[model samples]
Target: MNRGLYEADHEAFRDTAREFVIREVLPHLDRWEEARLIDRGVWVAAGTQGILGLSGPSDFGGADQLSDYRFRNVLLEELAEVHATSLSSGFSLQDDIAIPYVAALGSDEQKARWLPGMCSGELIGAIAMTEPGTGSDLQGITTSARPTGDGWVVNGAKTFITNGIQSDVVIVVVRTDPGGGRDAFSLLVVEEDMPGFSRGRKLEKIGLHAQDTAELFFDDVVVPHENLLGELGAGMHQLATHLPRERLSIAAHAVASTRVVLRETLEYTRTRRAFGRRLADFQNTQFVLAELATRLDVTQAYVDASIHALNAGELTAVDAAKAKWWATDVQNQIVDACLQLHGGYGYMTEYPVARAFQDARVQRIFGGANEIMKHIIARDLVDRPDR
Candidate 1:
């Protein structure tokens, strides 16, 4: 399968991204994993390379690549090649989830204040949505923001927040109306220095060791009225509007990562001997690879089409959910099988496949669980009942 997904410009961008990963990311990966955090310098280096704010406004030093998601796909592919799952997830949190909210909904003043720093990677961003009690149920969030004379006082806590520890700015989702309706929630941009805003301990995870996932607490943190993102009482709609892109972004990474594991497994089987014969010479090995390859090609086609659809503004939440769940499920399965093929070596942390296996677990969990994705698809099916 030629894929035929990238043009010359995209290929050129791919080269630049690959070079950046090789130089800036590969060397420090081990140290970062040991420390459970990526160095702040890499973000700055990425910003310097014009990679951080691809979809940001031009006035704020962004390339404004939002319309063309293929550039982001290129970056995802390159990161996957190195099995940099932690780094890839961290970047996606910024580029796909957090930045888009600001770019799309922030006021002109908000844009002027934050976009430049975000684009330059001097200011990291995180979106706090999931609470200790709320996962997919945004309506159930208890984080409250009350209007005050000077500003809004925000009080709540968020868990499983990516970049939580390092984020210079956090877009905190808080309930503004206690009545519990669709219009109750609003997003408040909480800066680092805000009083009563504090970060909990960095969470320990089975994978994504270098990525900072943490719990955030807002205790009477006063966010200025000007810091509200999007219209008040419209948080649910805003989150709904942005979710398709976020899911698609996850799907892109899932497929790219699956391809990396498959490629590496192919090479490993070609040389590694089993029972005095090459692993590739076995019929079972050949059959397994053939099956995996077919699935990869078919899934790649659908994902590519979805990318094009997303760029054209036609990607629906249903479709994005399909891509996200399917690709991530396939990625986990493929990586597990690849690890099986590697036998004992795959279990060793020294091997990329082992780390990939661990990292792939969360794909089905986050960006809304795969189960949630199925619920969305099922709901759509019932609603249409025609197609």
Candidate 2:
């Protein structure tokens, strides 16, 4: 399982990322979870460490490692080692989703205004796509922005938004045309203090307590025409183009988490005794661990290859769906089995396995539900025009 996925530079970056997590993440994780929010200070610290804006150009204060995703993968693995998944998810949102979208779609002025601060972690960003009623169906979005004197009046609500509570810049997806169609939607950048832009309560969830998730409301908020991201009527295309990277990032997290839980389980089984023998001595435990290890290795290979494909700009949306669904499925399965092996202790929130079990469930649901992933894959296999 050498994988050979990382180069010397990636390993060097890992050292830096690992040190940061140990210093900034591990000690505060419990307190963050208790408060139901991470302190903004951690975001600044990560920016200073060059971990927040890997995708931005060096001129924007980023590390300029966007094309090589291996560095991001390295950071994820290091975070997974300590079971700091909530923080991992938050950072992933910055590096993988929000930053990339702005970098790809923002005009020069937009980039100059936003990229440097985003790289510095002084500015937090979130993409608001899921409405109160819409999840995967982008066409169903009812949040509409109508043209007005000098700007557009935006009205809508978005729920289940990551970084919603803390985001300084939000790329809000709104319908430019009342009539629903592909050409109807557009992206408007809404700033923090915009009138009628408000955040609802921070949502409580089964897991990811340390990461902020909230409901956002926009009622009659006037967004400048200059704040528009990309072309009008191109929000759908922009979202589709960027979704593969989000899915791949999720796959990477799933694989790294699976490896961590499996490793911990192995160590637990070898040390803990039951019925006058170590748990590892039991035939049942041995078979279970054997199966889990094999599955992890197999899944890791696909994710690794997917990472390479992503770096080469060859990872298709369909392939990303495959990696996302399969890797997360394996991750959840392995974590559940590992938890069961821990007996009652696994049910305790203090145990990382228990926390991982809760955290792993959302992977299959977010970044497009695994069922949606299957639909995408199935459509490719059965509904192609070539067929």
Candidate 3:
């Protein structure tokens, strides 16, 4: 499918993004993977090139009015073509996860304190929601911020936080009013200079190695009252509202990645031979690719539609969950099969397919696990007593 989702301006942005990746990103991926994190300098470089601020406002040194998701989809697509998933991941966190608080919920002072630094890449940002005892269970979080004289004192920990260590400022999800039921949670911006705030090890993961996922701790750390993001009682609602864009972004990457591997797999199968005959000549290979292509198209349609719905403010959490899970599942299947078609070479580090295989495994796990996503989708279904 041609995926008629972008205007010429988006194409122009794609060209710029492609050049950024070629010039600033791809050359550093291996080193980043080895170091287990992206250097902070690249973030600055990205800001200068205007790749880091898709959703940020023009006043904040960002692009003009690309708060729409379609622009983001194009950014992901261009980056995905080169298998630069880590770069895509970092950009999504900045745009999808962290920036919105400033855009939608920040006080004028808060936005002033953050947005300029963010746009300049001078002050990095992160959101810490998943804790030691809770992963996807948002309401089950244990991090606490109790009342202090002039502020609130936060304590407890978070794990698997993207951009954790590198972040100069972190948006921490904590229980502000314990025993107030699910509405007790609140988001507080914890600066790195805050006392007793610490980071645990940079976690080793199955994929997305370049992402700086780590454990963060707040021990009797005081957060000024002004650091609170959004209404305290509305934390869940805020998260729910923001998650659709995040999941949709992930789905976009899923489809883009699938196409990359699928393209590579097709070329490989056509040239590589078995018993003096091309692997593409095999009925089994043909059948599998056919099925993969169909899956790709169907999944692509859902993703494309979800993008449209998102722009229209009509994409629900359930539909976003469905798109995220299905598209990633399709990406996983296509990449795995594509790898299998390459035989042992697929397992080698030198092969891009091999690296892609490692990278694609996490798609279904993060952004809410596929199982969690299905549960969300199931809950979103309209109940019929007669059925």
Candidate 4:
């Protein structure tokens, strides 16, 4: 099926992204994975190549491409082609989750101070929402920020933060009005070297070893009033507004990754022999590939439509949730099936299929678990019974 999603400009940008990945990313992946951290130099190189901050303001060196997400989609597709899940995840955090908040909601001073560095990769950004005790329930967060003479004193900890170890600026979600209900939270930007601010050990995971996921701590860390983002007590609203984009970004990666692994597996089956015949000659293999291909195509069409809707500012939270959960589920299933087709060799770390198998498992768990996604969809369905 024809995707018809990318224009000529997007295709041209895709070539540039592909070249950048081959030259800058692929060579360092193994070393980064071994060290459980990516070098900051690669980030700088990406910045120099105009790969970071694509949707940021033009004054801060951003390409201001927010209206068109196809550029970001192209970059993800290229990264998927090479099985660079860790790097993809890291970049997505910066581009999709962190940048949008700063670019869209930060004050002028905040924008001037951080956006340039962020665009240039001089400063890495991370958003701290998930606490040790809280995952999806923002209402349950206990991280508190109390008023002080000139600033707010923050005390709390966040776990499972992407770029947690390397982030130079963190947007911490803190409770501003302790007794207030949904409007109690606020976003405070915590810069590096703020007193009492520290990081826990980089977490070990079953996959995405090169991506830095860790715990962050803030005790008596002073965040000046100037560093606050958006409305003082509107943190929940801000987060809600940005989540659709974040989930759509995840869905984009999920579909792209599934396509990459499927293509590779198809080539492998055509060449690898089984019982004195090509693996592709087996009836079961053909049927499996056919089914996977059909699923990918159908899911891709919906994702593509969602992307267009997002650009048009019409994508809803419910729709984004649908795309995120369904696409990730498909990605995991397809990748697992592809690995099974590889026989014993699939279990080896040297094979991309084995690595993909490890990386795909988290898709269903993160970006609000698939169960949460279904709940959102069901709630919407119930509220609008006419549809």
lDDT of 1 by residue, 1-387 (tens): 588989999999988999999999999999999999999999999999987888887988888988889999999999999888898888888888788899999999999999998988999999999999999877899999999998799988999999999999999889999996999999899999999999999999999888899999999998998999999999999999999999999989999999999999999999999799999999999999999988888888889999999899999999999999999999888999999999999999999999999999999999999999999999988888586
Q: Give me candidate 3's TM-score against the actual structure.
A: 0.96
Across 82-163, the per-residue lDDT of candidate 3 in tens digits comes to: 7778778887888887886677888888888888778767778898889889988888988999988878999999998888
Pairs that collide, model 4: none
What is candidate 2's lDDT per residue for 347-387, written digit by digit as tens? 99999999999999999999999999999999999988886
Q: What is the lDDT of residue 214 in candidate 4?
A: 96
Per model, state how many residue pairs clash: 0, 0, 0, 0
Between candidates 1 and 3, the one scoring higher on lDDT is: 1
Whole-model Cα lDDT per candidate?
0.92, 0.92, 0.86, 0.92
lDDT of 3 at 132: 86
